[model samples]
Target: MKIGIIGATGNAGSAIYKVAQQRGLDVTAIVRNAAKAREVLGADANVIEKNAFALTAGDLTKFDYVVNAFATPTAYQHIDLAAKLVRELRENKTTKIIFIIGASSLLKPDGTKLLDSLLQDENAANWIATPIEQAKELTFLKLIDNVEWLAVSPQANFVPGPAAEYQLGVDHLLFNAAGHSIVSTGTMAEALVDQIENPTVPVRTRFTVGDK
Candidate 1:
């Protein structure tokens, strides 16, 4: 199947891109810089050098599945980009989208959103906007019914590492055996491609992945 990954040079995107490559899938890196994508994903990497916001419906609908791993320093763009993509793919029948969102929208053991606890942290002001907007992105997506979409959220302590065993949860936050809410980029990639190849999570629903 053909797959296109936006922001394929970033940590999560790069990891997923590499996994897709190893699986011998027809995967292309939708990146801003062909040079940077080459540096991160080697010279032979399939690339479409363009700004994510500049992508057109024709560009996206060519793939069977498009994974939005887009990240930016301007937090609100998360929601904006999600809207843009949905608009472009409205009523589309050929391509589906998988959004990689933050874990802030997941529920804690106490039944409150993890975003609530994050808002209480003193340092939250600096980086909290990203999660907040991502939560809004999910919220906005839930209101749409005409598109084929699925969102995947990583654990609270998402980090860079090789692949490991993982567990999946819906809505609720999950902790591994050592009691850490963590998921490696490799593990997340595995989960993503697995879903792409054999999707079980229904369209329009969101799921979380945690290291096991």
Candidate 2:
């Protein structure tokens, strides 16, 4: 299957790209900077060097799966890009889009959205917009029934590391053996590719992953 990963130079995207390569899947890094992507993913990495917003339906429809791992400090771009991708694939069933949105939308044990607490943090003013917009992305996806989409959310603390044992949950926050709501990039990558390869999680739904 052909897969294209936007933001392949980023942490989450790089991990996913590496895993896809290890599995010998036909994968391409859809990146804005060919030099940077080659530096991160290796010189021989299959690449589609272009701005994500510049990608048209024709570009995306070629891949069986396109992962929206795009991240930016602009914050609102999270929702903007999601909508753009959805728009490109509207009414098309052959191609699927997987989103690696953050954990801001997950529910706590008390049945409240994790975004609630994040909004209450005094120090969150700087980075709060990312989660807020990511939540909105999920909200937008939920309303679209025609597109084949899958949203995967990491734990409260998404860090960079290698893969490990992981547990999956739907919509609720998950804690690891150490009582920490954390997931490594490797684990997230494995879990995500697993779902993509196996097709267990239903389309148009979001699932959470945490280190086990």
lDDT per residue (tens digit) for residues 1-212 in model 2: 89999999999999999999999899999999999999999999999999998899999999999999989658999888888888889999999999998999999999999999999999998889999999988898899999999999999999999999999999999998889999999999999888879988998899999999
Error of 1 at 123 (Å): 1.4
Model 1 lDDT per residue over 71-144, tens place? 96599999889999999999997899999989999999999999999999999988899989999989999998
Residue 26 error for model 1, in Å?
A: 0.5
Per-residue error for 59 in candidate 1, Å, reads: 0.3
Q: TM-score of each candidate?
A: 0.99, 0.98
Q: Clashes in candidate 2: how many?
A: 0
RMSD of each: 0.7, 0.8
